[model samples]
Target: MSLSAHGAEGAITNALTIDVEDYFQVSAFAPYIARSEWDQRECRVEHNVQRILELLRQHQTQATFFTLGWIAERYPALVRAIVADGHELASHGYGHERASDLSEQAFADDIGRAKKLLEDLSGKAVLGYRAPSFSIGTGNLWAFDCLAAAGYRYSSSIYPIKHDHYGMPDAPRFAHQVREGLIEVPVTTLRMLDRNLPASGGGYFRLLPYGVSRWMFKRVNAADRQAAVFYFHPWEIDTGQPRIEGLDRKSRFRHYVNIDRNYAKLQRLLGDFSWGRMDQIFLPDQQAGAAVV
Candidate 1:
């Protein structure tokens, strides 16, 4: 779809996304734990995702799962289960490598492999892709071209806020056509004091009071009059997962803070607003009548 193809419709329905990676696979933990040890670490993602599925079921909500191709290969049944439950199955690339870290060809191969693997597993056209950690930005705008070449219709790969790890502070906050056929729907942010504040999910959602997060999303809906894009990982809600030892205080705090309360907080979020898959909300042509939620 082109830029002119997208239109703002009434009845804003926010895009709810899940980055389906294990706790050990988080970008922050990459320094402490090597990718070779990923297979050795106790795999808790299956259980965690099942819990997430149940939670969404209770709330009668549907979401986009930007799942890792690595996980899908090991747990094909889980991929089938997500499709069986009627959720959109998207790609999180083959491995969780940041697009900024890869050569264009390597990035192309990664996304291509993941897209094919996911489509084969789910027997559905995988139309969306999200970078490992929102790693696509001005430096690697070519990643958008790669995504379009790989046949992905949309990408939620950029975060508009400034961050030490990954963000393009000057990027568009709302969905925009970054390539001929691909849309870059960045995660939500709130404009405050002349800067983009992180209003969507991730560590911020866990660190702040649930009320604050709710207020931010409401502000985006009522004030900005735009549907918000929120995201989180499965491991975030698992308080009992084994703690990684000998980590920097910053990484430790960012990963584990408020894990005990996040699940309940997420439950409240589901009830507070309307949510739907990325394709339904952004690629309206693929999901006609979805604009009204």
Candidate 2:
């Protein structure tokens, strides 16, 4: 049930990732959020995530939830709910801060805080992390050493594309080893001739119709040698959230463009490919003998 099929047989085993954060809580939304006005709006994010939980449960699928330490501290019940449902839990840093905003020590402290909080609440080892907004690229690759030192096994933080906000234009597409014994599971992209297209499923998928997402993903499989990782937030399907203010037209368009159609499109994806956790996708080839856990 990992994201690609098991990364054997020349393709990926299925793996699903849930980045649990509110719409108002994303770093992109931070600029407009006055700290004096923020708190756990449990009504919005928690309630909406329960919808995601319902979908996964309905499909009997288990996923890796990259959660905010801020969310966990305020919503311990929700954290417990995810763990109790047998889903894997991972970190999304503390307070939704980006890796670039912190010094090396600050980032390490944030990771530690999140890890300790998640472990204490869920009673499980938090082995994975994802920097907010794909914030670990060329200049900030040093964050990897801190993550590995903080006892993380893998990170899903590199976008490997040139986005206005973040990306590592020259990073590898598939999973590779980092300097700190950390595995880099970069977002999926389809390479055509010399171009790396966004096959790592995300807002691009939500904005487009199911046919487009399906077509591009199929092309990724047909061309690329492994499973293309797909990620979407629970709020992407929650069309009823309050319309935000202070965003430019581009942010407004990207965030809310195809809300009505996304759920149906997601239903299509749920049926299209097998979905599981990171632990499952990166499962070693037993036939090849265990390299390391």
Candidate 3:
């Protein structure tokens, strides 16, 4: 059934997304681990993702997996498992390369390669794309054009909050059209005291109390009257995964803080909100004639 069909009057069905990547592939560790060395690292993604799939299955929820081509290539069956379980498959680029770090041609090539690969593997037309680390900004507004040209219908790459690494503070706080045929869905945030506060999830979800996170989503639904887009990496749920050393205290905290509580918090999150895949929540019209998964 479609998201609209599942909801009551004025009920908001938020988007639940997973960034499918391993522990070492995170941007925080990019300086420490090279892409060439990615193969040498121990892979914990398959098990972590399986755990996620099981949790979602228990909740009877669906989500979009913004996967890396690198992971899909190595774990094709895991990719198939996600599709088999009635979830949406989207591109998170081939190598988890940041959009801002790549040239125009390189970015195009990366997304193009990843999109084709995922579509071929899943036997589904991948319609969404999210840049690694929410890296697209004003300088790369052209990335939207690139996405449209590459056959993507929309993107969830921008974060409206101000962050040291990535953010387009002036961007739309919710989903909106970027180019003629492409939509840009910024990560959900709440406006309070004239500033956009991080509400959607990730480390922020881990760092903040569950009550605060719950209140943010409640406000977005009750006051703003819009669906919230929440995202977290599969690695977040794997508290037992190996950790890197020699990092600064801040990096250590950002990556490791609240690791143990993630699963329970996620359980609460899944129950607190009505969740659905990104395409289902944001592109219902485009998905109208498509086969139900």
Candidate 4:
């Protein structure tokens, strides 16, 4: 749909984007071990994604499911299941490689492979992407142009925060346009002490009390703005999954923190906001809602 259709409307409906992958597959923890090790155990992730699909369907909500191409190719039926439920199928890359970790050409190739794989599976245009770990920060801004050239309408890779890894400290928290005419939907953040912190979703959604998360979204909407684009992964709700060994104390904390709170919090979010597809959440003068896993 054209932004012109909602040109003057205030506070666009919120978007709920689910990155349908296991938490173990996230790029943050990938450096601790060989991906081939995780590759050996795939069924856990598959089952977790299936569970998310059923949950969203039960809520009667349509969300954007940014799926990894590796997962899509292996679980073609899962991709079909998402589309069958009227959800958006966006690329979450072939594997969980960080865009910054890959050279521009390599990132392009990765995204290209994922786009082709996902489109072929869903039989629909996959016009959106969310980098693993929000890895497409300032250093890899070139990735945006690559996405636009690859026929992607939007990306949600620039997490506007000050983390030790993978955040653009100066990036906008709201959606905006980028070079090559591609729109960049940045991950959400809140102003804290003049610095924008990542209270957008994910671990924060799990870490913060439900009241905090609910109030933040309500605050953004009350300011006459669109509801913030929120995201999380299926593995987040599966607290029973086996934890990886060799991860640092901090990595373990960030990954495994607040696993059980995710499901109930998500249900609260669905009840509180009218979630829409990412493309529909695209605001005029800004871009689409790009989220992560």
Candidate 5:
């Protein structure tokens, strides 16, 4: 679990991550889509992930896939394909529940289940975990203790912004050791106008113009000189996925804004900056532990 910067002499290698979950599983849609209804919904994750893999292949980039245990159990081959294509297979917990909502023991069980499930499927030690909707914060700092006890070496679960739903604005903007064995790599952000702006991707990446996103990331690299952690979801690229009804206006806008144009923007992003897996950038000494299975 030793850490060292892995960027080249003049270029910083940013961490590119994908949260592998279906569109129906978004935290905002929880009120509309019940967990029991998850099985009845048409699964698009397999196809969407295939497209993502092809996109990464075309760019010749490797990334970290924070895959859900639910998705992995159902789409085991998809997980294998990600590993076979040389990406890091990390856990996104088992059920997509927010860490802040779970008791420490419940959170521990969720992470443990996901780590074992992902490792059993991919034959790699699952070293990373991202909470659903960036749900880990000051209120649930014990989640880090759970992660460490569950054998996770790092977490990308904290979003350092002032958001209505999830963010710890005062947290470190870059990776830092939060516990004895675990590192907390908050998603990339830009400090501006005495406030932290969301630059790392997700809804913000889609909401802002491509130029704005690009400028923010470039600033982080040139000004901060730190490896920026950018994340997106498989569902973000699936414009054809089934739409959920009864969503409030804000939820609808946040989930579907500019999704049709996201894939192309992602291509531009891949070409614009250097990208690599999370562990390779942040935990340079640890191998991804890829295995054939």
Candidate 6:
């Protein structure tokens, strides 16, 4: 599909992305669940992902899956299934380590390991990387350099908003070249009354009214003339997954609110707009150059 087509008057194909990690591995739950105990916890990621796949299939849309190396290692078949279904497979780093918390070298190693593992399993070059929890920020600008050096062509790691955990409020709000050849696609946000509002997906999609989210994307497409990058995790649809206890009220709210309603909201979002794989929408030319293992 041509980029201009999406940019044209009535056909705007936004980027739909899935952050493929289990509920237990989420950053909000990191404080409560130790990484060492990950294997012991019930894993609902495979089924949750399959559900997402079915949803996408019903809509006949493709998306980018920023899969965790941990998940890919354990569910190689699921990773293969994603590729087999004609979706883009990208890296979400191994072990879900935050970029800000790791040294430059450690961050590089984490992405490198995950990228290679994903490429091997999916038999496709993993050209994109997203920091776990959108953790790459002003302090860790070196993360982009690491990504470029490690053969990544683009990154969707920054959220241009003010948040306690992660955001680079001043970063470009659309896809743009960051390093010499690397592109940084910040999460979609709307500028209203001189403030940036989160319109991209995630818990924000769950917490906010569906109409508001729909309006934001429509405004972005109609006024800004740019495709929005919408994202969510697999576990968002698995409302039946076991819940963790003792999380502060804020964490609980952010992670669990509107779980039962998200799947339908996603269906509405899917039907309202055109969608495509990230590479197809943003890095079209490089697709042929994607690494082959």
Question: What are the runs in model 5 whose C-alpha is more than 4 Å off?
Answer: 1-9, 290-293
> Cα lDDT for residue 25, model 6?
96
Which prediction has more favorable TM-score, 4 or 5? 5
**Which lDDT value does model 3 have at 274?**
93
Q: Residue-wise lDDT of candidate 4 within 235-259, one digit each (tens)?
A: 8889788878888888898888889
What TM-score would you give candidate 2 relative to the actual structure? 0.91
Clashes of each: 0, 13, 0, 0, 0, 0
Estimate TM-scores for all models.
0.95, 0.91, 0.96, 0.90, 0.97, 0.96
lDDT of each: 0.90, 0.78, 0.90, 0.78, 0.91, 0.90
From the highest TM-score down, the ranking of the candidates is: 5, 6, 3, 1, 2, 4
Give the C-alpha lDDT of model 6: 0.90
TM-score of 4: 0.90
- List the candidate 1 regions with Cα displacement exceeding 4 Å: 1-10, 287-293
Per-model root-mean-square deviation over C-alphas: 3.6, 3.9, 2.7, 4.2, 1.9, 2.1
lDDT of 5 by residue, 1-293 (tens): 32324355778888999999999999999999999999999999999999999999999999999999999999999999999999999999999999989999999999999999999988888899999999999888999988999888899999999999999999989999999978999899999999899999998998899999999998988888788999999899988988888889999999999999999999999999889999888886676664523
Instruction: Name the lDDT value of residue 214 in candidate 1.
Output: 96
Candidate 5's TM-score reads: 0.97
Residue pairs with clashing backbones, model 5: none
